[model samples]
Target: MDRDAEKIHHDDSISHSQREASSAASTTVFAADVGDRTTAEGPYPRLQDQKDDVPQQTSAPAPPSDTAPQRGKWQKAIIVVSLCAALFLAALDITIVTTALPTIAADLNSGAGYLWIGSAYLLTSAAFTPSWGKISDIWGRKPIVLLAAAIFFVGSTLAATSVNIAMLVAARAIQGVGGGGLVVLVNICISELVSMRDRGKYLGYVAIVWALASAIGPVLGGVFTARVSWRWCFYINLPITGVVFIVLYFMLHLDNPKTPMWDGLKAVDWLGTIAIVGGTLMLLLGLDLGGVSFSWSSATVVCLIVFGLFSAVLFVLVEWKFTKNPIMPLRIFKHISNSAALGVCFCHGYVFIAGSYYLPLYFQAVLGASPLLSGVYLLPYAVSFSVTSYATGLFIKKTGKYLPTVWFGISVMTLGFGLFIDLPSSPSWPRIVLYQLVAGFGVGQNLNSPLVALQAMVKPPDIATATATFFFTRVLSTSISVVIGGVIFQNEMERRYSYLRASLPEDVARGLTGSSAATSVGILAQLPDDQLQIARNAFYESIRVMWIMYVAFAALGMVISVFIGSHILTKEHTVAKTGLKQERPVAEPTEQERA
Candidate 1:
């Protein structure tokens, strides 16, 4: 009996042990399966894949709960048009206000404060640009763009209603914040939507928007100032921005970025932000004041310059070591091509923007044309820019070569700038028109090439950073160039006015001394014919000096373009639909594998 009881207990223990072993094996298998699934689908499959599974619906696609559907051709066209309009609005604001500045100053009795009207916008725009790029990377493109547009609209409203010069300047600063973001965000969105091979073509269309704005802004401003009110210049943005918001709200769709807002805010490099903003503001202030409001050797100017340099050094250090995410990533400069391309971009801005601002001045102040007619005269440059940009894009798309085009364009641009130096004191209208067309053609050819080449070289994830940095460098260069141009032009005018003092009455000399040195055509028109002719000759000589500077910058750009080495154009998209890895080479299967 005892032996039989022991056997029963052993049998029960064996059965329990078997059950425990089976449960352990099942748990191990289940965990392995979960790991495999996670590895295959990735972290954001739920967010990215939902777009593919979305059912066709009629009512504006339900706000894209997880992911947005791939935009069809019609949708893309609509979105592109909307983006073009948004970009046009921003670009238009830059030049449109220039023609209206005198009106604004006169109305508000701004005096020297009128300088801040344009400088404030440019300063804030350059300072805020990089941060906007970094922020868009964290928060997704759509939200940041929408927010920028809203801010711009509010600024325009405030600017239009501003009762004082101080208020108008402040409002322009607010507008700069939005305008800066709009420029960066538009490039990023296009990079995402179009493949690298096709991106140049689309970007070329965007170039058209810029060209048209450059050409039309002053004309439009003149029309409004002449016929209506200068306030209409600010108010004009209202309808255009409203249309952009409505269209983008409905038509623009992107994957809903899942990062929590609080997390994104924490990740921001606030220290770097402060350093860059302070640095840029100081630098711009120093440039704007030097030889204009203050002598170059003045204590105020010297202090600002020193502070700007020190802050810039601090910004570099912070970006290199301290920040997890940098506003302008140092890693991008790792590629020699990228660095060289950006250098070219900087030089291009110096030539392009300086030319844009000064050419109109020449027509109005030297050639004795009305403000409206001066803008019309710019059509040769503007039309050539638009046509050549589109054509170059097509050329690149077909041949998949941009390096040659870049080289040719920069060289031609240098030649064109040289041609400008030969314009006589009183040149014919056709001569001015022809020279402008030459410069515009050269500019258009390479305007979008650096951006295209940079996009092709880097992986997709860095597109926004790369784009913003390129634009930042360009905008900063433009701001500096404008200030430098202003300094040179002003100094020349002062020297000329001083030389002419012996030939004129004391009151006449004094009249052209302070505020009237940079007087508009309308104001200059009020002068006697003899005085007007003297003013024209002085301006003509000063503008020629400016053209010499343009020629030098353009020549430097040509030299830099030689180093932007050749790269193979890939047919595959840079950023994949999954948004995981950014750099992947196109893989073609071997013929033997087909077997």
Candidate 2:
């Protein structure tokens, strides 16, 4: 062909492909920034010509097409508020029940039952998170989110009415199935609604919900337990979810990729799903049970961990070779920036979550604060976290940069935890408040920035998968952190068992030692001043030892943050076609193409 003829043909192909890009069945074509080397090197590859192993990169996102209307300010606000509410309920359940654990245990005659109550929820929530993210792509985000909320509603109802510890445990597991989805789906929906550049500012709203939930969960749990009934903890979810369901049903509108039911079913990666869920369950179970229900060296723990690792390997292989549509796509991990951001997320989840759990313990054991008062003492952390998270989000939006926030957050977190290691047996209020503020400020910066980084790095087609994978990493890290922190604390307690046994009466000491000792934390309140002092000192020392683990994770995050590559924060709102419904059925392939 002549040069002009070839140019004409190329322009025709570009036009054809750009049209296909808007179809629900194909990826959206993101325009590259001026002078972007990736696109400048060659013509952009058409979807049919692209291979699974290759990932597309573009810094500038094209404006939304005529078909998908841009959301106005109020419309965006309503959608964001609804998502935040859903996230609030899910995060609330994670912490609220902690304050009521002792009451629940006593009422149900459950010894060491508090452990399973929390473990069951975390287990299911973490295990199912990635699945929710992937399936939302196939089924559309709206239906999946609604389904998740409904399941959570049922679980909360069952939990509220449960008469036995076994029933409560089962109920919480069900809630986790939904809670996991809510946590992931809300974030996914938010990503869809805004560009990476503006996402942080909106994510600040999410951070506020999280902070409120974290700050109030314990307080609310205490109030219900002391003033009414602990069951109210579950009851509170009913109203919030109801409002979320109603509001979202009316307001949350997005393109549905009207895939044929049969095709959608076929698109499901069954093998990958089973492998990931099973592996997550087994791994979490092993970690939760090891040293608590059974010795770390027990056959049960060993077998579960081994099988889980094997299954995780199988999951990777299935996604890589077997599945046409993987639940967790391997392409998201192809970039160094994504890998580094995920590493930072893992460390953030590890140190920050475990630190939050232990802080209340310190207040209760060392400071002689009740559960309610402990929650109050944690206000500095919660408030600082909220403030910094919001402020950082605004900063990211205004400046269109995330690396600096990530760097500062992780550094501050490491410094805060380092200070924690040297906390006196009886810390002054100002010292306690200031240290928590430092840590919380750091934690807040991380709340959304790493996710922002991950989203910015991947192509539009991979956004949901990338977001899901990112969350799965963080949630999994949190579960591991808790279990490992528990193991460390339990061992420290064991090392000092002789001291505790000698210092207190035999019966009192017996109740406060061994695996079940944590359930007896309330007993410290009844002890004489001298006995309380001794008990507090033991707890203070044991918990202080746990701070080393936090410091290590924070430092690791700081190091990882340094390696995270930068991506341009584009203003155009773009999303992968995975969730958008097609305007019409996809045309059947010709015989020649099929062959």
Candidate 3:
């Protein structure tokens, strides 16, 4: 009887152990499935090797459970059209001044002030971009967007009536403040209005507006400066802003949080704000002024650059440890995928924006195309980019995949830049157009994917913050790239000055080798055929070096994008609701705060 009892007990024990193992297996499978549906088992398994270090103890603020309220098709169309109009005006302003810079300088009699007109706008725009995102999160998107439009209107009015360079530069600065907000807020609004899975489709519309503006801006600037007045460029915005305002006022309706005025005011990270804004302005000033207004090694340049770096570091420290309502939460970087996406964005901005700026110079100087013709030449690139951007978005929406597009885009971009290195001084139209089309198509594929991937990786509350940060990085990198491109081109020209000047008149050579080398392509038109040939060769070679740099950045972007793990973009949207009495979405307390 004892032996039989022992056997029964052992069997029961074995059965109990088997049950425990089965339960463990079920739990593991459940966890994996949850991850698969949300954040785990990404296409890039390599990134998963390093465990995500997002603080487990401190969770992000829970976003509103309310889904975005659906609207009729016409309502959605109105919202998109209004946002596109706003984007068009802002984008138009960015490039409209490029072709008119010479005339503006000549008219204002401020040769020294020309750079600041553009720089001021860029500085304020980039500096205040992240703030707009945070501010909109608190104050609501509608009010902030309206305020942005108002400021832009005022700035445009002031710019049109400016009697001096100082006034014009300050006006542009005001415009930048509004322009930055307009751009960031529009993006935030889109996030609220659409699911992450469907975002690319609408962003394609935004891309079209930008492309149209870019294609026409320079041509319009040239025509206005030549046939009418450069002031018309500023004047043009007034009507567009009016249209945007009217459309948004009547049709746009978004949820606003019911937080009191004083509470919202207190929630802002004032110190961090000062640090980032001040630092960005100083840094951009140093970059824009370097080699143009001052020697790169001069005291003003060195001090500005150094102080800017220090301030940036200070800003990071403040956000990490000091502010509960941090302007840019450091936790966003805790995810490897986010970091990798940022890297890709950085390179994209560096390569594409700088490429756009320099390509015009190449056409005007090397190929001897007129400013207007150069703008015309740019159409192929702009059109290809716009078309491809829209198509890629549709492709992603249909397939629910972004990594393949991202990888393929960067690969093609690398090849395009590589092809540019072989472009000759007397390249045929087919060669020029075909090369640009290749590069533009590649760039278009990437225009929306990185941002989509970034939004997919973060919590709903972090979406606006992440979007703002992404633009900030892109803007900052663009600033750096334009400066670096200028430096490389100028230095290359200087290196070749002795050889080129040997065949040219002293005055002509001086003008070509001076601060205006890249911009003063008009000088080439005045040169003798032999001197013009020399100048073209020099410009082509210098631009070739720039292409080499772009190729490197494109390759780096591809490599960086490799580690960006893909997440399934959620169809459900859970953005914050405004005008509702709800707790603000601030960073959750640390362990110490909890204690």
For model 3, give the 10-residue run with minimal summed lDDT: 47-56
Model 2 residue 378 lDDT? 80
TM-score, candidate 1, is 0.81
Which 10 consecutive residues of model 2 have the lowest summed lDDT?
Answer: 44-53
* Number of colliding residue pairs in each model: 0, 5, 5
Best by TM-score: 3
Candidate 3 accuracy as TM-score: 0.88
Which residue pairs collide in model 1, if any? none
TM-score: which is higher, 1 or 3?
3
Instruction: Compute the lDDT of residue 244 as modeled in candidate 1.
Output: 96
Residue 422 in model 3: shift from native, Å?
0.9
Task: List where candidate 3 sits over 4 angstroms from the true fold.
Answer: 1-40, 43-62, 102-111, 226-228, 578-595
Please write out the lDDT profile of model 2 over residues 500-571, one tens digit for every residue. 888899787777666655657899988999898888887888888899978988898888887686655766
Against the hidden true structure, what lDDT does model 2 obtain? 0.81
lDDT by residue (tens digit), candidate 1, 324-436: 77878887776567787898998988998866777778888887777667777778877887888888888888887788778888888888888888876685867777888
Alpha-carbon TM-score of each model against the true structure? 0.81, 0.84, 0.88
Q: Write candidate 3's Cα lDDT for 399-493 as tens digits.
A: 87889889999888888778888776895888888888899989898887899888877655667778899999999988898888888888888
